[model samples]
Target: MSAGLRVAGVDGCPRLADGSGGWIAVIIEPGNAMKAERIDRLAELVDRPEAPQIIAVDMPIGLPKRVGPNGRAPERLVRPRLGMRQSSVFSMPSRAAVYAALDPRLPDEAERYRHACSVARATSEPPRAVSRQAFHIFGKIAEIDGLLRERAALAGRIHECHPEVSFWAMNGETALDLAKKVKNAPHKPGLALRRRLLAAQGFAEALTSPLQARALKVGEDDLIDACAAAWTARRIAHGQAIGFPTPAERDGEGLPIQIQA
Candidate 1:
């Protein structure tokens, strides 16, 4: 829709057997927000002629070099900011690990795990390991990677954000006492906490409505994550976002490999 400057938050997940996995973008205009999914939906929002000022997505934005690797610089820098929950920021799987995850002949889950870890070790300094969780989500990572690389115009307008970091910052940048949310954790209280923080920012209605949260097919945590990202996007578009590295490190392709919240 042709409109004034808006901001957005996007999160992605795997494509389920039902073709259900994709991206979810929470768009925030002056006083309105609508949730959407898929790369096409993301394009519809970010590719408009007027386009949003900034669209923050909860995905790793860049890849490490073929050689001389340190995984990603921002992960190292952003860890301290996350404090007690620093482990929430996993070292992004190197580009090689990403491609390896897509291999069809990887056989069983163990084989896939081995391949991913091996690639990560060879590509990173001190060898960052890709969690099984991270390996499973590589499809989403690969999808965003393709979109950003193909549609170069989205560069300056789209930024990388980590939801936990966003949530921490939203709550005055302090550590949370609760445990990290698990998928089967009885209705996710973590979402409730994050929802409260977002409500304070005026996204209360969207986060509270069942119909609204179901608009995106991703998991509950992913939806809350997208909300946290929206909060960060609001800051960036309004010139209040805090960048992890004073001068962000960019990938060889020039995509910023930094975290912002």
Candidate 2:
């Protein structure tokens, strides 16, 4: 890889008061300078001028037709290594379930959630339903899934990554002691721990600072998560990153089914 290659780290963000939500991205340039932006669509990141060479996104990829007991291969492989943070890993349902959940005719979110769970239970081996956390992000998952299926060229550049897994890799392959949130609220100690880890990876205060993220409607935790993913993107660009499974699996659509960090 050229020393001038650019990479990005991205995480889904909360909706604005105007009923719009999207992803937050941290684009790391050649010299480590960063650009943080809120993009309303995943395509915006991929289609922008000077698009990133590698995109390490905190979103699920590669939906399976029938999920096994541990969900997809990647979730099962990395969850155990996360310790308490394992809860952050949601078991992905089948491709049909995901597509059904995002059906425009569903009317509302609650209806979509219920409909998705019904499909999920029927498609999963152990008859599992989708978690609320996971269900909420089905649209985001669908966005990337559709993008990969449509643009074969992007399949290699855009990768699935989890912040906790990225953080675990950054913390010398050990899980962090604290949770990023408690009762759905940010935990300062945990955020501090993550910031320290990112700093150790050469991230400057400007990129990781909470105040800078707040103005953009991006949560502090999310900003930290995006930075962690960017760290993984850097490692990947340098051929230093590793996938959850020793060898990545593939979905029916041929999308890679492994999380890399």
Residues 138-194 of candidate 1 have per-residue lDDT tens digits of: 776776677788888787888999988888788897866554465446255666777
Give all candidate RMSDs, comma-separated.
3.3, 1.1
Model 1 residue 55 distance off true place after TM-score fit, in angstroms: 1.2
TM-score of each: 0.84, 0.97
Model 2: weakest 10-residue lDDT segment is 15-24
Worst 10 residues of 1 by lDDT: 33-42
Scored by lDDT, model 1 comes in at: 0.73
Task: For candidate 2, write residues 1-261 as lDDT tens digits.
Answer: 765779999999987887665888999998878878888887888898999999999999889999989899899999889999999999999999998889899789899889999999999888999999888888899989999999988988999999999999999999999998999999999999999998888888777888878877889998999998898898889889989876789899999898999
CA lDDT of 94 in candidate 2? 97
